[model samples]
Target: MRLTRHTDYALRILLQAAVEPERRLSIAEVAEAQGIARNHAMKLVNELAGAGLLATVRGRGGGFALGRPAGEIGIGEVVRLTEPDLRPADCENCALSPGCGLTPMLSGAVRAFLAELDRFTLADAAKGTRVPLLIPT
Candidate 1:
């Protein structure tokens, strides 16, 4: 199943943060690095912060960083937080919905997909990635 842009952006944000565990990154920095809009990055960062996946600071020299260790953050958990709908198919409007087995099959597929993601952490995803020099303003 194709994941939404929201989920994609969220993962990108996490990976960027994971790349620099010691440095706090601003939304603009992440947006520039990920090629996403600043507002979008801000929204996702706020959401991630709210969920305790990211930690945010305010005022001068304020920015964000991973809330916990990279190894402690599960990729699947991030996906679940960002992906509102995981259904692979829309069997609800189908005439054969009542008798269709596609729904359960798709559900199982989604489960399997998430389960696989659960096996990896942000650290796994950020391995060998070069950390850019971003001086927070």
Candidate 2:
């Protein structure tokens, strides 16, 4: 399934943090590096911080960092936390929830997708990129 732009930006932010763990990063740096809007990155940073994906500091020299180690953070968990809805389709609107052959197969597919995501860590995401955009602290 395709992730929304919000989720995409959230991933980018976490990946950025993973790549540059030495110093805290500002939303502006992340936005500029990823060619995304600063406002968008700010919102994504807030969302990621809320989900325990990253920690935010206030006042001078304040910025964002991973809430936990990069290897400890699972992409599936991030997706679960950031993704607005996990459902592949509204099984509620679908008449298949109770008992439908199609429902089982579709649900299985979603589970498989999540399982794949679970195999990767934030470090994997960080290293997966060809050239990481490392921002200064």
Candidate 3:
């Protein structure tokens, strides 16, 4: 199952913010640091701001930052808010919803995916040793 670009960028934003709670960041900063497209990062940043995940500031000495505490945000919630729905493909949502055994299996897998996501929070992403944050300190 492939995640939407929005969801992927949202994760990037949150993880970027988590790395450095000492200051506010901007979509530009995140895009440059994460090596993602600036336009895409800006879109994700706006969506995250709307979702109350990050706060934005204007002007020279301003940027963006995490809206709430890191530990208070859940990975699953981010996915849910940004993704809207998680289907392996649109074909899964076709008229086959009535009696498709594959649907049930995929449904179960989705549940499992969400359950796993629920197990982690922003803190997990921030402190993760595998993919460290790229904050400017």
Candidate 4:
């Protein structure tokens, strides 16, 4: 299963935030660091904040930070939240829908993949070490 760019950015964003729990990062800062577009970063940041992964503060001196502790943020949960759809295929409209076992098999594979991701958290991604965040302080 391939993750969307959105999910990739979400993980990158979370990792960056987790690396510096005390610092608030702006979308521009993150975009520059990750080599992503500012608008894309902004959209992902807003969605992440809405989903409770990150906290956003407005106005001067306001920026983004992880909403919860790194250890508490599950990678799988983030993937599930960020991914638009997890279906392996549109079996409902497939020509072989009548007798296809592929859909069920594919769904099982997706479930297993997600279950594997559930084993790790943002803290795991951060490796429990304080790394220099992509966002400049």
Highest lDDT model number: 1
In model 3, the worst 10-residue window by lDDT is 128-137
In candidate 3, position 62 carries an lDDT of: 82
| TM-score, every prediction | 0.93, 0.87, 0.84, 0.91
For model 2 the local lDDT of residue 101 reads 72
Tens digits of per-residue lDDT for model 3, 5-94? 788878977887887778888667678877789998988888888989999898887888999999999999999998877876565457
Q: Output the lDDT of residue 64, model 3.
A: 89
Ordered by TM-score, highest first, the candidates read 1, 4, 2, 3
Identify the superior model by TM-score, candidate 1 or candidate 2: 1
- Over the stretch 11-120, how does candidate 2's per-residue lDDT look in tens digits? 88888888788889988777888888988888888888887889999878999999999999999998888788876777777666777677777789989999999999
Question: Could you give the C-alpha RMSD of every candidate to the true structure, in order shown?
Answer: 1.3, 2.1, 2.7, 1.9
**Better structure of 2 and 4 per TM-score:** 4
Model 2, position 68: C-alpha lDDT score: 94
CA lDDT, candidate 3, residue 38: 91
Q: Which lDDT value does model 3 have at 89?
A: 53
